[model samples]
Target chain A: GAGVSQSPSNKVTEKGKDVELRCDPISGHTALYWYRQSLGQGLEFLIYFQGNSAPDKSGLPSDRFSAERTGGSVSTLTIQRTQQEDSAVYLCASSLAQLAGGNEQYFGPGTRLTVT
Target chain B: AQSVTQLDSQVPVFEEAPVELRCNYSSSVSVYLFWYVQYPNQGLQLLLKYLSGSTLVESINGFEAEFNKSQTSFHLRKPSVHISDTAEYFCAVTRNAGGTSYGKLTFGQGTILTVHP
Candidate 1:
């Protein structure tokens, strides 16, 4: 089975420009996650979506960061008016569900976003 | 709220020698523990996990972690290491019971394991 996949392995954009990173979770995966890895923060959880709607979005750093999942598979993370600080590797992961006992997330090769 | 504490930010060891990466989490409740390895320029990969049944879990690559409830720790250990083991290792935990939390992974600062030959 194919693991999670992300688009535009590397993205370089001007500051203040909006960028959208896409993620394709494994087929039949019911849950998707978006995370950011920065030099300062290490690895931070951005959001989690079950099917379509996100349940916990507290990890989103600011209003400029937003994400959505559609058709219960593909998820896009949008960064509006990207700042220099927004330059980081945006990672996506998926799993069957967020269950406690036996569910493990499968990660995708992160999309490295560089705001120039 | 839950948090992960990886005491050592880096661990350098000689090839073919034993190694241990310490990880401690705040919560003692029923939780899922995992160790992830991030190779250079690659996504984080699941090294191993300790969910239930066994206090000791082992990865096919000779990596193992013991779930110590009394210590609130899940330290990853490998009796022997190779240069290929050079990468960032993350310790994560989630407070999930009966399918909850959306499998949100709270990772530590990460430990850079450098195996020098």
Candidate 2:
């Protein structure tokens, strides 16, 4: 089975421009997650979606960041007016579901976003 | 809230040598611990985890981690490592608050493991 996949392996954008990163979860995966890997912050959870429930947007750093999962399989993270701080690798992951203890998450190669 | 600390930012060792990457976490609530490794030009992969019962867990690749409740640590260790073990290692934790927290992982500042031939 194919692991998770992300689009535009690398993206260089001008500051203040908008960029959209896409993620395709594994087939039949019910839980999806977005995380940001930055040199200063390490890895931080950005957002999560599970089935038809409301997406958890708590980890989103600012209003400029938002994500949506459509039809329970694909997700898109949008950053409006990107800043230099937003330059990092955005990783996507998926799991079967949130089990009692925890579920192993399969990660994608990630899209490296560089804001100039 | 939970926080993780990976004591060593980088570790360099010769092939077939023993190595240890220390990780400590703080949380008021019970949590699950995990070790993830990212090879160069690759995505993160689960190395191992400790959820309950046993305090020690091992990965197929000879890496092992011990969950020390009193010490609040989940340090990863390898008796003998291969050059292929070179990669960035992350220790993460999530609250055991069941489905409410959605298993949001709080990661440590990763440790870059460099194995020299």
Q: Pick the candidate with the highest lDDT.
A: 2
For candidate 1, write residues B11-97 as lDDT tens digits: 999999999999999874577899999999888999999887889999999999999988889999999999999999999998756
Best by DockQ: 2
Query: Which residue window of length 10 is worst by lDDT in model 2 chain A?
Result: A48-57
Q: Which stretches of candidate 1 lie over 4 Å from their true place?
A: none
Tell me, by TM-score, which candidate is best.
Answer: 2
Q: Estimate candidate 1's alpha-carbon lDDT, on a 0 to 1 scale.
A: 0.91
After TM-score superposition, the amount by which residue A10's alpha carbon in candidate 1 deviates from its true location, in angstroms, is: 0.8
In terms of TM-score, how similar is model 1 to the real structure?
A: 0.96
Clashes of 2: 0
Per-residue CA lDDT of model 1 for A1-116, tens digit only, reads 78899998999999999999999999998988898999999899999898999988989999998999889989999999999999999999998866653588899999999999
